[model samples]
Target chain A: MLDSALSVFRMGRNMARLMEGLGVTLEISVVAVGLSLIFGVPLGLMMAGSNRPLKWLLRGYLEFVRVMPILALLFIFYYSLSKFWNINLSALTVSIFVFTLWGAAEMGDLVRGAVTSLPRHQWDSARALGLSEGQVSFRVIIPQAIRRLLPGVINLTTRMIKTTPFVFFINLPDLLKVGQQIVEVSGLRYPLASVWVYGFIFIIYFVICYPISLFSRYLERRWAS
Target chain B: MRRARFLIVALALALAMIVSVKAQAGDLDDIKAAGKIRIAVFGDKPPFGFIDENGANQGYDVYLAKRLVTDLFGSPDKVEWVLVEAASRIEVLQANKADLVLANFTVTAERATQVDFAKPYMKVALGVASPKSALISKVEDLKGKTLIVTKGTTSDTYFSKNHPEIKLLKFDQNTEAFNALRDGRAAGLAHDNTFLFAWTKDNVNFVTGIDFLGDEDTIAPAVKKGQTQLLAWVSERIEKLIAEGFFEKAYAATLAPAFGPAVDPKSVLIEKLN
Candidate 1:
C-alpha cells in the first residue's frame, strides 16, 4: 500500500506540479488577505462611526456578500463580467478579486462586531478623560478592538485559504485541481492513485491551516493573560 | 456629502470601464496580430486533452491544437493554452478567454446555438462503462439505477433529457465521475465512447459493455459565435488537415497507445469532409 502510494509522487514532476499548484493557492490567499486588511479595517471603522449613510451602505455590501455563494460570485466575476462587461481579467485575477471582496466584507463585519461589543462606558470614560475623539479612537478603542479582532482575522485568513479551491471551477490550476490532474493521469498505471494524491492534498491543506489556527490560539491565550 | 460624491465618482469610473471596451471575437487577422492563438483544452480527460506526467499538456486534442498553432504561426510555441473543464468550454469561448476550443468538444444542436463548430475531425457516441459483475449493456438496463456522468457532458445531457427514469449522479469533473463509478456509487458511468474505450483499457475491472449509445456525433473545434472569418479559416484548415491525413497520425501518436489493440482507429477518426 505504501509502495503504491509513493508511486504517485514517483511519476514525472507530479510532486513539483503539486507544489506549483500550492503556490497559486497561497498567492491568491495572501493577496486577498492583504487587500482585505488594507480596506476592511478602514471600512469597519467607518461602519462603527456616526455616519448613518456610510454605515448603511457598508451593511448592504456585507449582507450581499454574506447571502450570496462564493462560487456564484466567482462565476459572475470570471465569466459574466468578462463577457457582458468586457472587463477581461484573467482567471487568477478574477479569483483574487472575488476573494478579496469576500474577505474584506467578512473582516469589516468582524471589526464592527469587536468594536460594538465594548461597553458604552469605555467610550464615555475615554471621552471624560478629555482625550479628543481621534485620540480616544486611536489610543483607547483600536488597541482593545485589535485584541478582540485577532482570532477572527486569523480564522478568516484560513477560511479564505480553504475557499481558494473554488477557483478551480473557473479553470485556475490551484493545488486541488493539479492534484486531480495528477490522479487522473497516474490512474492509468495505478488504480489506487486517487487515494494517495487526495491524501497528500489533505496533508498539505492541514499543514497550512493548522499552523494558522495554532497561531491564532497562541495569540488569544497570550492576549487574555 | 463628500463620501457620497466620492462613491458617485467611483461608480462612474466603473461604468466607464464597462462601456469603453466592446466585446469582439478575435478574427484570423487579430490572431495574427497577437502572434499567439489561445486554444482551450481539457487538463484531465485522457487520450483527448490531458496533462502528461511532465506537467505539460499532451493528448489527442492538444496534439491537434499544437498543430493548428504551428500551421498558423510557423511554431507550436506561439500557442497559449487555456486549460478548461467540460462545463466551461462554451463559456471560455463566449467570454473571449480562448480563441478556439479543442477540448474534445462534441458538436450538439444545443451547443451549436452558442458556438460555431468547425469541421469535425473525430466521431463519437455515448458509452456506458460498468463493472463486469453487473454490466449495463443497454439503455433500459440503466432504468431506476444511478448513472454517473460528468456535468455538462453530452452523456449528462442525453441521460437528463432522454432517460429521466435513470437517477443521474453528476460531477463537475471527469476524475470525480470515474471515482464515483469505481466506488460503486452508481450502476454505470456514461461518457464518450472514445474516452470509455481508453478508460476501460486502463481500468481492467470495468467494461464498456454498451459501446455505442445515442445518435452518432462528431467532435469539432469551436469558436465564439459569429466569428465568421475565423470559423471559415478553421474549417478550411480542418479540410486541409483531413486531406493530408493529420488525424490518422494524431490517432497513431496519442489514441492508439491509449486504446490498445481492441479499438480500431477508423472507428473514431473522421478522415474526410463532406
Candidate 2:
C-alpha cells in the first residue's frame, strides 16, 4: 500500500524525492483548476449574457471538451503542434493548455447555468439600488454563485489529480511513472509490486482530493444551514 | 475511511490480476511458421515504424522488418506490423498477436528470459538527461536525484543495479519517459544514449553525460522462446547487416539527421565464433 513512497524510503533518497513527485501532481491539478475557474467564469458570464451566436458557440465548445477524452485531446495538441509547426512546447505548457481548455469549458458551463439560475430578483434589487449591470453581476450575483463554484473547483481538482496519469501519455513522469520505475528497478518478482506502487498513488490522490471534497462539503453544509 | 479502504483493496486486487495475466509466457515459432511475424512496434517512435503521410508504416524498424520478411520467405509481403505500447509489447508478443518484437527492444536478463533476443542492431549505453533547470554535469551529481525510464528497457536494469539509491520515474513508453524529463516531472531521464541523443539533440541546452554506466549494449529484435531457426536467422541477418553496413546506410539515410552522424560501421559489427 505504501509502495509509492516505499522505493524512495527503501532506496534512502532524500525526502524531497517523495515530495517532488507529489508536487508535480499537485502543480498540474492546482494550475488546471485555477485556470479553468478564471477563464471559465468569464466565459460562463459571456455565455449567459451574450447573444444567440455567442451562447451557441460557447455551449458547443464546452460540450466538446467535456465529452471528449482528455488523452486524445492531449495527443492532438502535443503531436500536431510540435510536429507540424516545430514548436517545441514544454510538457508543462501542453498539460496546462489541454487542461485549461478542458477546465475552462466545464467552468464556463457551470458559471453559465449558475448565473442563469439566479432569480431575476437578484439583478432587479441591484438595479433598484441604482447599481449598474456590472455591479449587479459582481456585487450581487457572483458573491452568491462563488459558493456554488467552490464545490465545482474542488471536484475538478480531484478529477485532475486522478487523470494526471494521462500525463504519462505525453511523457510527463507524474506519480504513475514513478510506480512503473520502482517496478523496473526493484525487480522483486511480485506482480503485486505495481499494486503496491499504484495503490499508494491512488491513496496520495485520495488524500489530497478527499480533503478538498470534505471542505467543499463542509462549506456547503455550513452555508446551507 | 472504512469504505475507502475496501475500495482501494478491491481496486488493487483487480489490477494485480490484470498485470499477472499480461506477464505470462510467449511463443515465437508458432507465430513465424504461421507464415507472418507479427511485430510490436511504436507507431510514433521516430526512426522506427511510425505512420507516415500515406498512412503506411515507415521508419528504420519497418525498413528492417521488410528485410526480415524477405529473409523469412524471400518476400516482403509476408510480414505484419502490429502497433504496440510500452506496457503491451511483452503482452502482445506473449499473446501471439505479435510473433517477435523488433520495436527498439532492449536486451536485459529479466526481459531476455521473457522473450529471446537476437544480435542487437544498435549499440548504446544508459544515459542521464537533465533539463536546463537541473543541468546535470556529473554522475555523482545525480546521486540523490530522481530519473525516469521506460519500463522493460535496459535503463531500468542499468539504473537498478548501478544507482540503487536514486529515485526513478518509470513510464510505459519513450514518449512518457521523455515527457517526464521534458516537463521537470523528473530530474533526469535514463535510456539508451542513442535515443537520448536522438530525442534531446534538438534541445540545445541539454547534453549527454560522458560517464558511461557500463559496457555498451546493443538493441536487437526479440522473438519468443524456442524459435531456434528464427532466432538464429535473425541473429545471423543482424550480424550480416552490421557487417554489410546496412545500419550505417540506414542511419545515414534516416536517423543521422536526428541523432547526428552514425557510428563507424566496423565498430558496431560483432564477430561470431563457433
Candidate 3:
C-alpha cells in the first residue's frame, strides 16, 4: 500500500501531464451532458409524442446508435460525413454531435418511459383541473417527471462521462492517454508505476463520477419516499 | 461412486483443455509446414502501408515485407498479410498475431526492451509540421503550444521526454491529429517525416517544421524479443536489402511523389555490416 501510494504521489510530472487529459474528458462529458440536457427531453417528448412515425423514428434511431460501436461511429463521422458530404464538422464537434445524438435519444427514451410510467390519473387530473397542454408539460408533467427524470439523467450523465475516455481515439488527450505516456516513459519500470498510474486515473474518474452516482441514488430514494 | 468418479475425471479433463494455450497464426513450424509465413502490417498509413483504390494493400512497407518473406521461402506468395493498427499491434505480436512488424515502427530504446529489433534499417526521427503561418521550426517553438500527435506512438514518447515543456495533445488517428494542426487548435503535429509528407500533400496548408530531433532514431522491423532465430534471419536480410539499394528504390517508386525524392539516400540507408 505504501509503495503504491508513493508511486501515485511521486509521479507528479506524469500526473500533471495526465491532468491535461482530464480536460478532454471534461470537455466531451460537459459538452455531451450539456447536449443531453438541452435536447434529450425534447427527444424523450418525441418518443412520447402522439405521432407514431416520430416515435418510431426516435426508437429506431436510438436503437441503431445504441447497437453500433462508438469507435465505428467516430470513424464514420470523421471520415465519411465531412469528406463525402462537405460537412465541415471538426473532430471535437463530431464527438459532441454523435455523443449528443446518442445521449439525447437515450435521454429522450428515458423521459418517454418515465413520463408514460407516470399514472394515467396524473394526466387526467391535470387536464380536468383546467391546465393547458403546455401547462401540463412545463407546469406539471416535467416538474413531476423531474423527480424521476433527474435520477436517470444523472445516471446517463455519469455513463457519458465514463465513456469520455473513448475520445482517446479522436486523439483528445484524456486520462487514459496520460497513463500510456507514463508507461512508455518509465520503460521497464512501467509495470511498477502502471498500477498506480492507472489506479489513480480510475480514482480520478471515480471521483468525478461518484458524486453523480450518489446524487442519482438520493433522488431515487426521495422519489420512492 | 463409480459414476461420480468418471464425472469428476471428465470435469478435470475439460478444465485442463480450457487452460491449455491456444495456437497462434505466427507459429513458425506450423507456418513452415503450411508453406506460408503470415505477417502483419498496417493497412492505412500511406507510403508505409495502405489499401489503394482497388482494395489491394500496397506500400513501401508491404513491398519490403514481401521481399523479406521471398528471401526466406523463395517466393513472396508464401507470405500472408494481416492488417494491424496502432492500438492492436503489440497485442497482435504478443498473441502471435503477426510474425513480424515492418510497419515503419520507430526503434525506440524503450520498445527495444520489450521487442527484438532487426538492425537499424533507416535513420529517422520525429519531426514537426504545421501550416506555413504557424510553422514551428524548433522544439522550443512548440513550447506553450499544442503539438498534436498520434496516440500510442513514438512521437508521443518523443515529445513527452525531450520536449517536456511543450503541451502535447494526442489523437488516435493521424488524420485527426493532422486535422488539429490544420485547424490551428494545435500548432503542429509531431510525427515521422513520411507521414508529414503524405498528410501535407492532402492538407497543403502545412509543411515540415523543424528539420527533426531526438537521438538520431532508426526505423526497423520488430519481432517479439527472444525470437533469436527469426531476429537473426531478418537482420541478415536487412543487410542484403541495403546493399541492393532496395530501400532507395522503394522510396523513389512509392513515396517520392508525395515526399519528393530523398536528397541523400547514402545517409539514410544503414550500411551493410556483412
Q: For this target, which candidate reaches the highest DockQ against the unseen true structure?
A: 1
Q: Is candidate 1 or candidate 3 better by lDDT?
A: 1
Q: Per-prediction TM-score of chain B?
A: 0.76, 0.67, 0.75
TM-score of chain A, every prediction, order shown = 0.96, 0.87, 0.87
Q: Candidate 2 residues A55-168, lDDT tens each? A: 888888988887889988876676555433334455678888898899888878888877888898988888999999888878899989887777767777677768877876
Ranking by TM-score: 1, 2, 3
Instruction: In model 1, state the lDDT of residue B180.
Output: 90
Q: What C-alpha lDDT does candidate 1 achieve relative to the native structure?
A: 0.90
Q: Model 3 in CAPRI terms: which quality?
A: incorrect
Off by over 4 Å in 1: B1-25, B127-191, B205-210
* Range of the 10 consecutive residues with the lowest summed lDDT in candidate 1 chain A: A183-192
User: Stretches of candidate 3 above 4 Å error?
Assistant: A1-12, A82-89, A220-225, B1-269, B272-274
lDDT sort, best first:
1, 3, 2
lDDT of 2 by residue, B142-198 (tens): 788888878977789777888798887889977677767777887777777766766
Query: How high a TM-score does candidate 1 get?
Result: 0.87
- The candidate scoring highest on TM-score is 1
Q: Is candidate 1 or candidate 3 better by DockQ?
A: 1
Between candidates 1 and 2, the DockQ winner: 1
